[model samples]
Target: MLINLWYVAEWSKTVKDKPVKAKVLGQNLVLFRDLEGNVKCTADVCLHRGGSLSNGWVNKKRDCVVCPYHGWEYNGEGKCTKIPSEGDDFKVPPRFKVDAYPVEERYGMIWVFMGDLDEKDRYPIPPLPEYDDPNFRGLETEFTWQAEASRVVENGIDIAHASFVHPVFGYPDTAEDNYIESIEKHEEWAVSHNVMYPPQLKGGFLGWRKLIRKDKQPTVVHPGWYLNGMTVKIQIDLRKDWKIVMFDANTPVDEHTTRTFAWQFRSFMKSPLFDKGSLKRLSTILHEDAQIVEASQPYYLPETLANEVSVKSDKFMSTFRMARRRCIEELGWQIDLDKRDSYNGKKVLTIPSPGRKEALAEGRGWVFETMPLVAPVKTPTEKKDFEKQVDELTVDQLNSKDNVIG
Candidate 1:
């Protein structure tokens, strides 16, 4: 069940008339934009003796990609347009075609579908709340590292690791007990949440100064396909001045290696803090995460093992893992527990979006619809009873097979 969906390959603006090579779901692809302004993605390997299409050049006039080897040309639809050695009257072999994936451009990123053509539109890339918001300012950066894609994604959701792994950006003392606030499912996308954090600083010199204050706002976590890679979106609201920070990350290249494209968005783009100093600070913070993430790679663990005791504030990690597992399973890629443990398996699929219904229909049903709403079950009596029951349960019971698991 290789569910087909779009994946963000690169910033739409990044691909010009020049060809760019990318990999999606383990397949090498060549992308380019023609004079007609349409973006095209095709197998980088030409069917004609397996030559690399990326090694060729783009013919803007004919809106085609020309293979460097022997001068074979392919149109945007991947149809053979010309063969240098053959006359125009010569019939082209059907096998002469190159593989083409469906592509869509949005939020400055070019998205390509890696699954079945019939289901292309069934799963749309997750929407970016900050993309069109005038109040938000966006900054982009690229990071190349020797690490698996799963490790990077897990790091993004692991709030606890932030304290030690990222001393500067991670505020352990101010860490809030985040719970899965809610999950919203759409025809093309899904969204989940961790506990909300207040804007007021609870610790640190900044906290003492009270320079920046925000309401207790929930952190939105969204993981889906964009371009030719996987993307994770985290949104936090700084209530005052309509300030917001949205972290948009994508893995254009995934293997034992990964390339991440990230952007920080805020309403105030002109402030000096955000201009030069803030950008540097943000880079440092990302670098911190990258270092730890890369280091943590060799010792990656499964989400099932991450179910150890969690404080009230540790709710986000659990909720995020559940949502991630759901997304992965929906995409028809199984979670190989053994491989995940070994750190050398397909831990995630390449589809930009997973068809919610199709994914849920495979097994466990859609938790979003079947799972009881627990956010509102916070009455004093209920809370006490729930905590008491969990406390009273034996270690075995707490870790029992019957317990609900992701």
Candidate 2:
């Protein structure tokens, strides 16, 4: 994961008056809303005895989070305000604080700055203009993948795979048919447009019936720029009056882990009842993509185009990979080549660390590099239990941020 970027920590409703745990870019953070209802995020570790603050509670009156172990209270600013062990008259040193991260509440998600707070504004979160349109309605879903963030984002944007991996979105008959009209790549972002003849379900209920029984559709796919960045969008026409957009906010939990929050926005179906069915179908389609992505090779992404084969239909995907490579090679972001064994293709376990940021003087530019250690995964024996895998999308991820498994 890169620094100076915004990553979804948790959905807004998930972080209410209670401290909630989330991990982004390998940082364990606790989120809670203050008295004013503004969200605040900080390192989950207690400054004193290394206790977890997520195991704590919110002090409603003081608008602070109280540590469960010793009742140490820290406010939104991350300043230690009260130490129950100390007498009321004892002055809590101003220097006693936890690492506070910048946070924003947008699109029903709580986003946190996973880098230097000063750099947050430079890389703004992707805007959703459709959200402001009264006629548009949507729902959000979250999923965790045992794959790298780059691979997960690539899966969402890949046009060719729709035919093979996602049967619901692409017909098996048109699996060999491919089309890509145009692609544009910028310094910070990139856009690719493709002409697609998608395969739809032949006969089904409301929306599905309309799509399949109608004329064989040739649609356009307008994908957002900067494929490897925090946001990815796929705008495709579902019908003349109704268009569907799948906007994904991809976050790296660690080197080989990802958190994806997708917003399925449709301009035509404004009814909430209809949207519920759409979300279920969309969630299932995305899960199909996940199964294939988790099985990809060279987990950290191949170093160059030479590392993998490509064709004409892969133009947009290739561009995204090129831009991502530039950031890793030219810019400071790097991949941990040593973490994976060359002979056996096995990943070694190591304690994960956050990315480091390097900046030029006078705000010229900056680069964030991976710290190189793989995030720790608990062996199943350690916990003596494995949580049941929930295939359906839920308010929270199928796997809560707290549980770790081998």
List, residue by residue over 86-119, the lDDT tens digit for candidate 1: 9888887644555566778887877787654465
How well does candidate 2 match the true structure in TM-score terms? Answer: 0.78
How do the residues 1-406 of candidate 2 rate in per-residue lDDT, one tens digit apiece? Answer: 5655678888888877789988876667889898889998877777777778899999969488889989999887666899987889989875566666678888888888765435523467777777667767877887788998888877777888887887655766875665666665555466677777765544336456564324447777787644333578888875576678878888888766788887888886476867667777888887898889888887766645444455555556655664565455444444344543342223222112221121233332312122353332322221112112212223232122421110
All candidates' TM-scores? 0.70, 0.78
Q: Model 1, which residues run further than 4 Å from truth? A: 1-3, 169-210, 214-229, 269-273, 297-315, 323-331, 334-404
Candidate maximizing lDDT: 2
RMSD of 2: 12.3
How accurate locally, in lDDT, is each candidate? 0.55, 0.66
| Separate clash counts for every candidate | 15, 3
